[model samples]
Target: MSTKHFLRGMATVNYFADNVVAARDWYSELFGVEAYFQMPSRDNPAYIEFRVGDDADEFGIIDRKYAPEGMQKAPGGAILLWHVDDIETAFARLKALGATEYDPITKRGETGFVTASVVDPFGNVLGIMYNPHYVELHGA
Candidate 1:
């Protein structure tokens, strides 16, 4: 691998929500902690950020109203997959929270990777995976 200093490990994952307040509340409740940062606005905030996981990676919820021109609102392209200890529990919890199932857990026979995904209430594709290589490298 080239030693370029660009593109570090998934520093942030962003999802847009039409109802920023409701998204913030739902995510916070699911994450079991309040967001650590938010951008203020006159009406509903433009952006809210949550820092989660042992690595304290950033997960953000943005107002769909602020989406840049040409940003697709459909449930396709660029799903953010988070590394989880238990794929089954993670997938189930998201569904229990009313997230629609997109893809059930699937394992690559040789690669040792397993993944599952869901379409959230706001239409974001959230994926969870058990990546043995990630754990082996990061000791998470």
Candidate 2:
């Protein structure tokens, strides 16, 4: 029997922050776009979402208070990475924007996959990678 690939693709990635507005502003500055949606009200939103990247992926920020009951307070766990054209430049820019390094850039084998992670100022883990496969498939 052949194994099925149930996970189609990344639908949305959400990060928890104590201050959703600040997170929204920071990400808006980084992506050069504003959040297209917010919950409740703009001035007191609990969640905000932005459509980013070539694929127009949804990136969301939610107030930590709304996080699952057992969510950890520190930045750690499954790091969902986003593709980047240059890992070094992206890592540097993240650092310059006040994100602390969680993992240094690493070349995975020889398949042209380089990855790095950082903790955003809001305590969310943000990962970036230079993936040849993604570039080949997406052309970006």
Candidate 3:
């Protein structure tokens, strides 16, 4: 018998936040995902993991204290962008989940990408993007 290991794909992207619980809840509601794991450390305080849809891959939220000091401030411009099939549907779902909508769905050139901005409960800016042409271009 032989044991093999392989890289399937990106599992998650982690963001640092001041309030782990709030961030976790915000992401859960916005992405319609649930936290699969939670670990606490003296320096980091709280670490959480959320799985997207039914996929095994997960997204992570870590306390600012655990991340590098400079990352305390949320990323500027576009902090996070999620690629969905339908922007309008995703936007409505997120809005219903208590997300504050900052912009309406708008197109992006000939690619047919639509995006909107929202702030999470912990003050992190997130974007919901729908680009059907993405997979064809990036080979995802």
Candidate 4:
């Protein structure tokens, strides 16, 4: 039997924050673009989103109050590494933007895969990577 590929691709990744507006502004500075969507109302949004990267992947910020009960309010979860053209520059910018280091930059083998992660001020882990394989398929 052929194994079906159930997980197709990444659609959206959301980070929670106590202050959604602040989170939105911070991310906007990093992304250099304003959020194109906000829910409920801009003055009192429960969620906001941006279309990121060449593929326009969904990156969202949600109010912490909307998180499910028992969800951990710390930077511990799956770290989704977004590809960056310059890992060092991107990592440095993240630090300069008030994010703390969660994982330092790490070079993986000789295939040109590098990774780093940081905890955003809102306590969500944000991962950045320099992935050659991804570039080979997607371009810089």
Candidate 5:
């Protein structure tokens, strides 16, 4: 028998919200495109999904009421950072749009990387970063 690894990059990101409808609407407005996939019905969906970026990364929103067993409803955890051209602008935009700052933007200086994070109103930790390595490896 042969053992192999098949761990690829992130394909889906799920966000839990108290109100699925509001979360979906908020994300729709932010993304500027309606969700291409939804469960039940778009008008009253219990779960919603959106495909984003050139890679078609899966982003999802699910009602907290339906949260899986043992899932904590706290406001802290591992952050999933999205690549951005300008960290400052992205950080500012998120804050202006009501996302409270969880971690202020900080430059790594020598590494040519900067990162910032915000707690979205729906309790998800939204992160934004300017990573030169990512640009060099994947292009901006």
Candidate 6:
């Protein structure tokens, strides 16, 4: 007999916030996604896991209450970058969903990559970048 194992992919990106409910709703609207799993707690009534897309089984969200203490208090200077195919479309969508723009789109070096940042309802900084070369190289 032979035994085989494999690693699938990133299951989710965990972010922390002071207000989980507000953060959850903000992210849902920003990504145009929905919540497939939500775990409530008295200490943090908004602990939730949001689906990244229509495929509910893949990606999700972990509210601050559910995250460890270190993650929960991560500084604002620590930005989380999310890779996307279209920076303009994603930025516009996030803006439409009430995300506050932290910075306009800018290219880093000559890599043909554009990036921008925004703040969620609870002040966690999120970044979106479009980089075809990166996609080809990293397979995101």
Best by TM-score: 4
For residues 41-114, what per-residue lDDT tens digits would candidate 4 score against the true structure?
Answer: 88888999999998999999999998989999778979999999999999999999999999999999998999
Pull out the clashing pairs in model 2: none
User: Where's the lowest-lDDT run of ten residues in candidate 4?
Assistant: 1-10
Pairs that collide in candidate 3 are: none
User: Estimated TM-score per prediction?
Assistant: 0.89, 0.94, 0.69, 0.95, 0.91, 0.65
Ranking by TM-score: 4, 2, 5, 1, 3, 6
lDDT of each: 0.87, 0.93, 0.71, 0.94, 0.86, 0.67
Question: Per-residue lDDT for 1-140 in model 2, tens only?
Answer: 75767897789999999999999989998999989999988899999999999989999999999899998899998999999998999999999999999999999998899999999999999999999989999896
TM-score of the candidate numbered 4? 0.95
By lDDT, the better pick of 1 and 3 is 1
lDDT of 3 by residue, 31-102 (tens): 666687888642344898877743455788888777775654644554467777777888777777776777
- Indicate the worst ten consecutive residues by lDDT in candidate 3: 70-79
User: Candidate 4: misplaced stretches above 4 Å?
Assistant: 1-4
Better of 2 and 5 by TM-score: 2
Candidate achieving the largest lDDT: 4
Query: Residue 51 of model 1: what lDDT?
Result: 92
**Considering only N, C-alpha and C atoms within 3 Å, which residue pairs clash in candidate 4?**
none
Instruction: Kindly indicate the candidate among 5 and 6 with the higher TM-score.
Output: 5
How would you order the candidates by lDDT, starting with the best?
Answer: 4, 2, 1, 5, 3, 6
lDDT per residue for candidate 6 within 32-123, as digits (tens), equals: 77656676653454556765532343434455556665653534665656778889988888788777899889998886878999876675
Off by over 4 Å in 6: 1-11, 41-44, 53-75, 137-140
Stretches of candidate 3 exceeding 4 Å from the true structure: 1-11, 41-45, 53-55, 72-78, 134-140
Candidate 2 residue 12 Cα shift, in angstroms, is 1.0
Q: How displaced is residue 92 in candidate 3, in Å?
A: 2.7
Candidate 4 differs from the real structure by a C-alpha RMSD in angstroms, to one decimal, of 1.5
* Model 2 per-residue lDDT at 115: 97
How would you encode candidate 5's per-residue C-alpha lDDT over 1-140 as one tens digit per residue?
65655866897899999888888888887777889888999888888999876578899998888888988887777889888888888888888878899999998788889999998889899888888988988887
